[model samples]
Target: MGSSPDIVSPSSRIRRALWPGLWVPVVILLAGSALSFSVAKRVSSQTEALAQQHYHLQHQALVHLVLEHLYRHGNDVSLLKVPLAKAMPQHLSLRIDTLERHTKKPLLQLGSIHAPLARQALRSELDIGGHRSMVTTMPDAQLLKAPAQNLRWLVLVSGMALTLLAFVLSLYLCWRNHQQRKLVQSHRKDLKTQSQKIANLNVEKVALRQALNDSENRSRDLINLSGNLIAELDEQGQIGYISALAADIFKQAPSDLDEKPFQQLVVQVDQRRFVECLEAARADQDITQADLALAADDSEQPVPVTLRLKALTDPVRGLVGFRLSAQIKTRPHD
Candidate 1:
């Protein structure tokens, strides 16, 4: 025999089927990533611009100090021609050199973000190599351009695209797996139904076997009672079945009373008494007795019989019937 097909679980199949069409979130991720990088770049630009402005102010202050000293000793210093060697303090000179060094690289970086013209103005003012120049020297348009622009767009686009693609792919797979899971569940349901049907069939077979056994016992009861009279009555109170022993008792063959009412054959000397016993038995669900005198056309004398009536309830029609058994009475003689 050939090998069976590998069964795919319902969950797995569903994920597979639904793993497509997840592109929108990818776009959102791209936008968010780009925005984050842009924010960082803008913040950096603001900090650098503030530092550059502060340094310019400090340089202007130092120059003002030098000019004030020159005005106060302009004549004496001009005669001596001693340059205002002590005009700017040593600490201020050192601070200016440090600020210039720290700011020059930032000016070049800012030039990439701002327009070329503005970037150049910033660079010329900050790029004071060795001489610590604080004011703008030459305005180069390129220096006005902004920095980190390339990295911003690159990071934003790339991050968003990657995140979005991953999200969509994951969702699609989940959907497909869900579908597969449902399919597997359906198969399991079918298998359960089949198992239940098999159980039901087994139960029915057992019931049938038990019924056959009960029938055998009923047949045995019938055989042992062959010498005794038995009769079955119908819904209409007609005698429907008579055993062979009935023929000997009634002085007629069992077949003679078929479809005939037993009341016709029995002489009712006390009809009221017979009906009273029957009604009492029905109402109380107890046994009631009545004596009957029956005679056949061929018999010379009447037969004394003690009638015992028991109730039978029909399942389908809810009708009540009676099982009547009779025994011929024998009298004692000296």
Candidate 2:
């Protein structure tokens, strides 16, 4: 039988066999890529968080550094000794400059918080006229402002790039996994089809063998039926089969006399004449009949039998078996 195209195709078999190895690695690669992307996003988030935290700490430190600088310069300026309580214009100017210098690029980029509070605190300490006068005194204020502004843009750009890279990696992994899943599905379908075909072939093989065996059994039964009989021949030229009816009259089983030469099994039967008739029947492809008497092996009386013999041919074996039937003659004296 010709196999279906799919079954005979090499590419289809290779697809089935390669699925496990090929697809597993693709799945692993997709998973790894996804995990790495997740980690990168987290790390980028952490970087932004750390940048914010650094801004908070630096803001506090800048305030404290300005306060300390003012205290140390107490003798140089009139309001320095009472700088926290008095309107010290010089100290306000120094504090702003200190803040500008102390804050790093990242802290500056994060920008200031509590701006209103810082100004209020400064106003509370200094007179409004002093604050106005000192605003122009801090050169570092402009220096801090420029770097801080630039740092914000730098951090934002870096974060955006990191986030974009993560998203790209995630998309790549997702697409890779989709391809692998499709391949695996194809392999599974192929395996299912092959398994079904194998099951059908197995069933067909079993059915054929069973049919062959049944035919042989019937033939054997027919052969056995044809061969199960005994025959006899007499001096007048006759040939015949021993029959079940004869065996019953003689009080013996029919099988015991089967296949025995007529002369050997039937005494008072002419052996030569019977052999001649058997051969003639075989040659002519015909049947013959006889009337004879045969002594039971252990008895003196001769039992009369009418016999019939039919030549048989076995087409399969190209040989002959014989068909025989007989009936015994009942006498009043028996």
Candidate 3:
């Protein structure tokens, strides 16, 4: 059989296979990771800059205080020693030197005799009592080290939190997408079923209309061929339709009898019996038969007719009228 040509093609099989909807989540995770890294880097740089600025300001403030002391006391190292020791942390060192302003000659030195290395120290220039002085402050490396480590840990935590949030959001989106796809599929299936039912109903309607038309044509042909008068009456006992033979029986045009009460055509003596038959047909929704004399305008004598009255019903309007089939009776004279 040559394996029936593999029934389903490889391409179609691949298309029917489940596709992992994880791509959206993967992209979101990658973007979130990149954003976290950028933010951490920026924040770290800012933290470092802030720390350096704080150190520079601290150095400036200390130098300014030392100059103020020099200005008030005039080279009195004794007044500054106690306050400097109390103000400066143990890991910091300060140096001050008084020089002649014009010549820049060293006149006096206080605190550290040897200047610390430039990398570990901050220096400032000041003027006190008409002499130029230099102030050097060296802050401890440990002062910035601890806070930097804490900031790094904080950045790491924030990045992790952001990554977790992104992951959760992606999962929710995937779930919602899956649910929406299912709902759409269900609605499509329902629509397909409804469409099929509507198509079936349309087919049935076409068949019924054709059948009704055929039936009506046959009934009309039969009425035309019969040697009798056929009439349709409304609920009020008024003639609605009469066959062509009505003109011969009533001695008037068929159109003239339309909307005329049936009692008008009945002889005065037979009117009560005709009315009773109509009432019986209406009350029971059944057929009732009666013999009645129909008065014709052209003859002095009345024509005898056997009337079959049946209730007329409509699918939507219920009992609408009655159908009367009348067979003419031959008289002895005729």
Candidate 4:
């Protein structure tokens, strides 16, 4: 009965058992941490290099087509023939800048795509058509932000190491299973934080995409509905694209008026004045208005009208054309 005074408590027995069990897990965690870190570092470099090369080849082709188009035909509406942006509207974004200080607007901006994290924007500069312009090509962000090829394996190994570590701790601390609860709670908190961040990013992307689409649609619809006849004149002041309103005003199909000198519509008395206006607008890159008599034919009386002209400058070529808006003059009847 004297030796029974030295009996061990339940807590002491649990503690003694837990300490001996932890050595194996501790060794495993150390080895897993060191090996995983080394592998991840090597894999990250190779992944980034491969991604860069893949993206380079994909976007370089687009840039080549863009520069070639500009070389063959100076910046004009004919860019529609290239059809790069039209084919994969989501995958490619193209921006062409003449780098001309006189004009602030870009020659063409075909798409809107955000660059992914940790990737450099793809840009190239070339002398095309005797003007130095820059072409920036953006690839689909989905490709850039895709998870690395071997990332899943690394995650699985790390998760296994952590799970074993947590298990050993739970066995080591047997007081109401305190260590296990702590590990589970920490993991849940981290999971919630990551989920919240991803949800927020998705919301922002949707809002921005929707806003851009709405803005583009509004601008296109407004241009078509504005009653005034809108036409783009080439370097020679020949109509390139005249709106459908041209049919009513000129009594000729818009296609029939293509390549016709813009001043040809004016009466004989105003031909010199139109030429003068062209020169002045080209020189100043300004808005100019003139009251002119437009004769569709001698069979019909000449219709008086006001012509508005604005210089359409190209990046490399100075005054490449003019954007003309013709408004039919309305007489106030007494």
Which candidate has the highest TM-score of all?
Answer: 3
Off by over 4 Å in 3: 1-25, 56-82, 89-142, 153-182, 221-228, 251-256, 279-287, 297-302, 310-320, 331-334
Residue 24, model 3, lDDT:
73
TM-score of each: 0.41, 0.32, 0.62, 0.38
The number of the candidate with the highest lDDT is 3
lDDT of every predicted structure (CA atoms): 0.54, 0.49, 0.77, 0.72
Candidate 3 — what's its lDDT?
0.77
Which stretch of 10 consecutive residues in model 3 shows the poorest summed lDDT? Answer: 106-115
lDDT of 2 by residue, 270-307 (tens): 55554665666677778877776655636446666665
Question: Per-residue lDDT tens digits of candidate 4, residues 1-334?
Answer: 3647579889887865564446555666666676666676667567667776877876787777776676666755256445766544455566677775667676777766655333456888877556777777676655553445456367557766776676566556543454666667798999899899889988988998898899867755675687666788998999998887766666799899999998898889999988988988888889998888776655566777788899988788777899988777753222
lDDT tens string, model 3, 1-334? 4657659988877754533376777777788778777777777777767777887777777776787787788867568877776667544567765554455443333344233335757878776556676777765555544456567768867886878788888778777777788788899999999999999999999999999999999988999898788999999999999998877666689898899998888989999999999999988889999998888765546889899999988889888999998888974243
What is residue 292's positional error in candidate 1, in angstroms? 1.9
State how far residue 268 of model 2 sits from its true place (Å). 3.3
Give the better candidate number (3 or 4) by TM-score: 3
lDDT: worst 10-residue window of model 1: 106-115
When 2 and 3 are scored with lDDT, the better candidate is: 3
User: By descending lDDT, how would the candidates be arranged?
Assistant: 3, 4, 1, 2
18-78, model 1: which lDDT tens digit per residue? 5344444455556666665776577656655654565456446544543444356542223
